[model samples]
Target: MSYEQAIAALNDQWSQGDMDSDEYALERERLDYERGEMMSAQDAPEVAA
Candidate 1:
């Protein structure tokens, strides 16, 4: 699934009390970091082969 969908699922889990605040925050941060990396890679200039 995409990062957006994964984040939505995480939010649902947190809302349903399946995850504690600490764990949810950690996971959310990790997801956000990964999303940022993916976005950065996509936006980077391509190198000449």
Candidate 2:
């Protein structure tokens, strides 16, 4: 799965209480940063490569 998709699934898991708070927060942070980078790259085409 794509990073965003995986992140979203993790979020769902967290919401469902399937993951602990600490693990959820950490994974959420990782995914949030990754999603930010992905968005930034999308906005700035030169960074995509």
User: Tens-digit lDDT track for model 2 on 1-49?
Assistant: 7886887799899889899989988988888798889889889978765
Give lDDT tens digits, candidate 1, residues 1-49.
8998999999999999998999999999999999987887788747322
> Highest lDDT: which candidate?
1
Clashes of 2: 0
Q: State, as a TM-score between 0 and 1, how close model 1 is to the true structure.
A: 0.85
- Top of the candidates by TM-score: 1
Q: Give the Å shift of residue 10 in candidate 2.
A: 1.2
